[model samples]
Target: AQTVTQSQPEMSVQEAETVTLSCTYDTSESDYYLFWYKQPPSRQMILVIRQEAYKQQNATENRFSVNFQKAAKSFSLKISDSQLGDAAMYFCAYRNINNAGNMLTFGGGTRLMVKP
Candidate 1:
């Protein structure tokens, strides 16, 4: 069985600062996938980023980046230049690489509150 864990239950960042959310997983499968999804107050689920197990390089988006430590089964998300809009519930998710439809297993989540 695979499980995702977010150690931080909540985090805060200044309007223009940066924040890192920690996540770790336990999976016996060598090939798998990791993802970070954001759920805003509106309850809309959005994909933040994803990392493939076969890739060595960390995945990055505009202001979002991941520190993927395959050996440790760790995948942390770093948000740069955090804005008020970045405040949301961030969930760490994992999926089996060979599974069809790729259902994601998610962590409890980390609530990010941005201060202006």
Candidate 2:
């Protein structure tokens, strides 16, 4: 079984500042994919970043980056130079490579609020 946890239910960051959202996961499988998704008020699930279990380097996309500690099973998302557009509900998800259905197991989610 695999599980993702976002200890913080809500987070707030000042505009132009940096914020890091915590995410911890437990999985028995060695090969899997970890993802950070953002859903705004419009309800569109957007992929913020992704990391492969076998990859040693952390994944980064523009202002978003992940601190992927495979040994510790921690995949925290760091948003640098936060902007108003970054405010959204963020979810940490896991997908096992062996699962044919391609279903994703998601965390409770953390709602991010940006302050001007």
Residue 102 of model 1, lDDT score: 72
How high is the CA lDDT of each candidate model?
0.95, 0.96
- Per-residue lDDT of 1-116 in model 2, one digit per residue for the tens? 88999999999999999999999999988989999999999999999899999999999999999999988999999999999999999999999989899999999999999999
In model 1, residue pairs whose N, Cα or C atoms come closer than 3 Å (at least 3 residues apart or on different chains), thus clashing, are none
For residues 1-116, write the lDDT of model 1, one tens digit per residue: 88899999999999889999999999999999999999999999999999999999999999999999999999999999999999999999999998898789999999999999
Cα RMSDs, all models: 0.7, 0.6
Q: After superposition, how far is residue 5 of candidate 1 from its true place, in Å?
A: 0.6
Residue 25, candidate 2: Cα error in Å is 0.9
Q: Give per-model TM-scores.
A: 0.97, 0.98
Q: What's the number of clashes in each of the models?
A: 0, 0
